[model samples]
Target: MASTPGILTHWPWEPLGNFKYVLVAPFAVHSLYLFAVGAEDWNLTYLLTFPFMLWRMIHNQLWISYSRYRTAKGNNLIVDRSIDFEQVDRERNWDDQILLMGILFYAVHWGVDVVAKIPFWRADGLLLTFLIHIGPVEFLYYWFHRALHHHYLYSRYHSHHHSSIVTEPITSVIHPFGEHIVYFILFAIPMVITALITRTGSIVSVSIYVTYIDLMNNMGHCNFEVIPKWAFTVFPPLKYLMYTPSFHSLHHTQFRTNYSLFMPFYDYIYGTMDKSTDTLYETSLKKPEDVPEAVHLTHLTTPESVYQLRLGFAGLASKPLTSKWYLWLMWPVTLWSMISAWIYGRTFIIERNTFKKIKAQSWVVPRYRIHYRLQWQREAINKLIEEAILEAEEKGIKVMSLGLLNQGEHFNRNGEIYLERHPKLKMKVIDGSSLAVAVVLNSIPVGTSQVLFRGCLSKVAYSVVSALCHKGIQVTSIKKAEYEKLKKSLTTQDSSNLALSEKGYNQKVWLVGEDLTEIEQSKASKGTIMIPFSQFPPKKTRKDCFYLNTPSLVAPKSFGNLHACENWLPRRVISAWRVAGIVHALEGWNVHECGDRVFDVDKIWEASLQHGFRPSGLIPA
Candidate 1:
């Protein structure tokens, strides 16, 4: 919002909230209705309008993903600032401007007969659109933008946009309702005149022009220096006509300068261009990628998990990620990501964070769980993990923790293969089993005498069950084989409390893992709590039951600038596996906890607590 809210401060359809699109639905349907009933060839003009609007939306989304991917690399970043949840929430309404444009366009098409009669092609009108845009549209927008920077208008309107000092591509369109109305009028000038005076406008020309605007708008705010200096040198005057992301970035940093829209001609002529634009651009382009002291190596889960990445949508990434109905519409991009990952066949940095003096990064292996499950693909998956470890070691990373399926006991003996292969390596490899055990054991509510342990058992489960039985808490298992297998690992005193029976149905607490059956879950009473020892969470089977999150703890305030969640965990709450790597790096630990090696869960829990990572109670709701 602005410093002092003004008239028409909100969109007329603001009350509709997420349903604001309903306002444009009728016009969209009417456009389709005309096409469906076999209207005249020229009447198809209205039908094309809706698809053009949709294309604009897809164009903005691509710019968003591309900008995030580039900036996450840490090189060529224009600003050394962060984007928090507040900025994401503020900019989420970027599509509202597109919705407003749709309304105004449908109104014009309905009122003007000439718009309906416009032909499929008009060479003269396209030429006029170019001339008129450079003449009236660009020049007028320059002054209009300048006027908005005046204290009064700036406080009431433009301040909302400057809220994001470190801009994303969508920041170009995040303006108040009144500001968008004026911008719509300025952009409409070329088309309106092309229709009224020359009467030679076509849907193709209009689409081409709007697409040009979207391209320039998205490009200007990417917060990276993609436009190379060589381009300006190759064609000198192009610099005068076009602007780079770093050029516009200066305006946000040092306000009251570089007020031109897409072209910098007006800024130069009016002497409003920032002097440091070129220097900033050159330096940003030359900046190096950051080197982290610790790296958490993990793999992708379900295909929908792609959007849950910090590089994806901010709102979705900031919360505990779950499958959404609308994600089905993003299948094209999902399929592309899968194909690209398969072809690229290597790890890529997706997230970055700071822990005091230590820099940490989360690198993804690009392969999903199903890929690792295939007998033929295990070797390839191991190869990817091996490459990532070598790369981290070469970069002087002190610690690397294998997370999720990347550390499967069957595949690599919990990341033990890398250690055996590289005997004298300085970097320590850990599977974080100690922390996982600590989080799970501490998470069980106090005074709970018995817990029904279900699902596939693993090393972490064995450690947790032993500790539980020793604590005088009764441990019960429904599977007799699992019970006997666990009993063999425990001393007689501890094993005395471990029981095997079909008594699981009467228990209120359950410690679950992979392949937990639906029938087993269905037998549990309502309001039962399901705690998972595995990195992957169980599917929510009963609405009444409580499903705790995977092992994770809340990050400290010192670990600032976190704008996204870790897998299914909420914002700033990191997985224990990831925290273990950082703690190991920070404390200068030189031990490996994998294969037959053991960890003191009590010691790890104490060390992590001392580092300010508080144990987060795992209830999602």
Candidate 2:
């Protein structure tokens, strides 16, 4: 909203919320009904409104996805400012304009067709729209847009749009209802004049005109200067006819200039254009991709997880990955991504973040967790991991962490195979098992004497058991094989604290992993707590018992530009494994934490605290 919003600032159907789409139904149904019954020569121009409206919605969403992907990559970015949840919340209403547009299009089509029949195509009519748009629509919007910048209007209207100093493609359409009402009126001039006066308007021309407006609006606000310099150099006059992303960016940075709607002709003619527009455009185009100090190598968890990536829908990425029924509608694209991962396979950058002095990035392995679990897929998966390591080696990333199943014992032997393959590598490869063990051990409730350890043992499980035993805590396991495995790994002093017991129901605290069974959890007495030491979280079936998140901690406030959650973790919380990579880079550690080697648990825990990572949901018993 504006600093001081005025009348009609909210959409006319604002009170209706999402149900506002119900208003468009009657017009749409009426048009379809007449066409189906052949009740008089139908105005196909009006009838085509439904699909074109749908097309416009999709067009806007595509721009949103592209803009997010480009900005996350950090190349060709016109604005380097951070965008948080506040900006997301504020601009979420960009779709309201599309809703308003649907209502108007349906109403106008129905009204005009009632007076006289309309054609389906007219090339001349489309040309007229283009000409009128340049002559009157552009000229009028230039003045009207400038007028909105005046004190009275800016406070009550334009300020709402200008709130986003860093713009996304959708940011161009965010405005008070009063502002959109005027914008629609101006945009409708070309359509209305060509149809009513010239009598040459057709369904195709009207749709194309509106599409041109949407394209220009989304392009100018995409926050990247993608228009190549070579094109402008070839045809100098094109600069006056078309405005680039950086040109409009200057208007937001320096208010009261560059007020042209889409074309720079008026801004150039009236001298409202910013002097730095060309310089800003050139600089933004030349900006290179940043090289980070550390990288966390992660991967897609499920088939549906493609949309959960930072490059996917912003609304979904800001929260934890979850199944949405609507996602089923995207089966074609989802299938394509799965196939493309095999064909065009490579580790790709997901997002970038800064922690104090160290710059970090999160790179994805392009495969899902299900792929890692299959024995047949092991060789292929390892090759991808190896390629990613060599790529990071090429980039001089100080430390790279293997997250989730990327470091699975069965897949790559906790990322040990890479070190054996390339023993002389400079960059440190961390499985993060040490810090993960620390997170699980410290996460146990205080004063707990004995706890049941469940599930299959991994590198983390072995380390966690030793650390617990060293603290004189009783470690009991239900599976004899898992218990014996831990016993052999433990030292004589630590082994004394390890026990094989079937009395798991007696233990109140349950440290669990992959082989954790529902039957075992059910046997445990009510209120038994389970803390995951494994990368994968155990299924939660018992309601009475408390379940802690996988080994992770909340980051310090200094972790800036971080808005999206890490996988299933909550906002601002990070898994211990991923956090270990950043700590390694910050401390400039040269040692590798892969294979069977263990870092000092106490030392790793202390270093984690010193660097400002707090425990998540770890409460005293």
Candidate 3:
């Protein structure tokens, strides 16, 4: 069985059009019945009930209409409201019609029972008949419902109801009328038989049963998880034995297990209940082609196999102890403990290695290793910068300013130092206190266009460019590497005679990069503008610097002087684990064990990849 469409796809609001008509038809019939019987007293109550029913109908209709209007206008009441209504309508089945008819029929039954006053005749023993009626009726309904799913019956009639996998409220009433009538007859037979046998009938019991059935049936088909957990908990055990969203949801998906709608005991006793709820009602019968070979490998190596092997040896060793059944049971217990210990140790080793690498870097401890790529973050920042630059450029501005200053102990009086005293790429030094760099760049704005800074300096740059944008000053990135690259790319014809002169360093183009403590000073001095970048939490601290000198236990026998190598072995192992498929399987198993029912295998894979696991040679091709 496959998973059904999401709940919202079959929301009740869609098929509300038929509700009013169904509801009115019942009341219309009731009104005629009351008039023919000359029941003037029941007339007022019937009139009141009509409006009550009408109110419910109108409420459903108005909600549906408003939702439709909102959807048509491309305004979603909730997130992810991108629905193809036409496609849904095209695929709609008759289940909804059956649901509506069922409700109407139940309502009419209740009305007839109320008008007949059957309870008045059996006032002394009414409760006994009610209980007897309920038991047999529930039993018959459960069996008949189960029978509908038999291979022969399902292909003929039942499949039509399940065709609309995601049931809409109106579609809840749209089942084939013939199926509905058959079901009604089957359901009513038990009650009628029990009533005859008991010799105690009650109109009140009939009315209550009919109303309860309609409400619950409607709820089951409503395609919404609106019922509270407490409601399910507090309801009688037999209530869950009948149809609920969870039960019905399973039925819709598998159409085999969970056949008993009014009682789960029947299904449980009949061995139809699926013990493993990992996939709920989803079909467990995997196609031969869909069964991955990896699953077979996993099963072969699972802890259960190891435990069985250990248990077999323990059982032989405990021959005398086996005479005492309780002592023999300890053999399996000891084996289970050994298996559990191995699993725990393996998990601990993996977690320890993962934490070690994360602790080695100043970078954030990413939720997943794939995030290290920083694709989305980089794209977003680039887009913002591009838009800002383009807007400024459109206004005839050529020069942009950036406000930045070197901080941290590695920096000298001149803002230049390798971040960690690296042997290559000596950092360029700049005067931290003086505004000379800003002034020089500001003067040659037209020729040396573009300024770039890390997000940490965005705010300061924003201040410097604010006045320039108004007066048409364009600014973009001016990093040395970028500048050199652009210079090489510029053609002689396109190149202007631009000189980086110190006089061009004017206050107008100088944008402060750090947080502005002196906002009043910045505004008062109209020449120099300052903007503050949004502050982010500091990066994680690296306790010790990693180099190639790290030794590896798995080094080749021919290798010499392993300690001389600069590569970090632990970091590589951590990275490998992050990308491993086994790690994801473990995570999935853990989530399921923890009782989080929903599982997304792809999400697990993506998270594993983001965390730093590269496949390398370890992953099977």
Candidate 4:
């Protein structure tokens, strides 16, 4: 364990394993003095140490990137790599970094006195200067970082930093220029004030402090566990004093904790240290072979993003010319959604759970599905949905499914709207409607030619009817106009005898159209069975009637639940959940938990597995 030079020599690169962090700040200060000021003054210390620090930074970055790629420990990474690289356009981030550096350092005309040439070694003065920088800077930064987490500030400023959960070297410096100005003012002002007040100020010391800060920032974002475990095991107190890549990574993944910059002392004092910080850090340090076969990374929007999106939604909904007056009237409802998001929409992670060889890690946005729908504000619903997909994609979610409402035919044509609108959203946006249709169709017995269609006019119901007819069932319908619409609409490829019949029906009935009571009243013969889409059966409904809705709507007795007809949701939800669960497990990708919270993939999987019954629909069509 001790003999490996690469492991021991690069111990600071490891997460939670480096105990010698105090030296890092001072060392960085010294190195910058050597590189930037070396040519001007020939000092023995400068000549010896300058080249090493410069090479160390570049070498560490290269080694970390190489190790992560070779080990393929992507699942264990705090974030997806694609987010750090692909999503953050290289040119833009580089431009931002270059601009900030040029303006802050080169572009500004600093007087010669700003960087002191005299190198004086004063042990007490050096220690005091380090303390001055650490104390006030940490104090001010804690508040500043916390302030940025606020809803409005996050969207406008801090969002750019949090954009890459799978952080990189550049991620350390990719702050919004506006945020940079503020951060610069906060950090520099305190150091400058401390330096002047102490009367031990030197350009060399100040440069060292700044260099120390930049080094720590890069180390915290390194995304590699270079620290050895022995450090923490040997001296437990070090955990509170030093920040690791895992510490900052936690801030990115779970934003509510570890906000302090260099040290976690403030985080502990404020009672904000994440409960799982130690455990998560340990988990991250595990070698690839030690972890599960598959690890999933989930993406969620910050509270600020939700608030911003909701406000945007309200604006779009309130657009007088573009939207319906009633939609405009729903401004209160839209505003209420924003409030709900504030109350409930905190970013969260579902602990990684494994099912056999596959692991499922779900990242959940706090906002409800209704927020994305814009609360009936149709004008902005599409845009909001597109933004949601883009957010997920930016977070590196490989596969995402939207709510049934968001992905319905009204909003999308076989996912074409999402595909066309967001060419950059490379992830799959599955509606699960195809699987839902398969499950719905499977509930019906095959080889039955004469079938009565109830909701033939509705697009979803029509699709079902068309599918049944294609499967060789002679589908009969009651809506004269809808039946004519289907007849005229069917192409040669979809040709089927979807008949309009007022005749007495003795065969099984597929209830999909509106006016369930009217259809029941108009039935010539007592149908063998009524397969309802969602609407509850009439009081006169026969005992054999079956409800075939996927994730069938639960109508409790308080809501006037009927006893005579059978609701298939009881049986249907199990199959649908299992299939989706298996898919999530097998693929280890993001599963969009849409619509009703009760029908989420997790709940469905638990219920389905407990029931221990596989419905016919598990097989994909």
Q: Candidate 3: where are CA atoms >4 Å away?
A: 1-134, 168-172, 189-203, 222-243, 278-621
**Poorly placed runs, candidate 4 (over 4 Å):** 1-85, 90-103, 106-109, 112-125, 190-199, 202-204, 290-621
Q: Which stretches of candidate 1 lie over 4 Å from their true place?
A: 329-340, 504-508, 522-528, 542-545, 618-621
**lDDT rank, highest first?**
1, 2, 4, 3
Question: Model 4: per-residue lDDT, tens digit, 441-504?
Answer: 6557666666776652434455566677666667776668767777675665555667777664
Note the residue pairs that clash in candidate 1.
Answer: none
Which candidate has the top score in lDDT? 1
TM per prediction: 0.92, 0.92, 0.33, 0.37
lDDT of 3 by residue, 164-251 (tens): 5544333344444455566666555434543555545554454445455545555554433334445545875744355544455556
lDDT string, candidate 2, 150-266, tens digits: 999999999999998988898999999999999999998988888889988877787788889999999999888889999999999999999999999988889889999888999
lDDT of each candidate versus the true structure: 0.86, 0.85, 0.34, 0.49
Clashes of 2: 0
Minimum summed lDDT over a 10-residue window in model 4 is located at 559-568
Question: In the order shown, what is each candidate's alpha-carbon RMSD?
Answer: 2.6, 2.8, 25.1, 20.5
- Quote the lDDT for 58 in model 2: 83
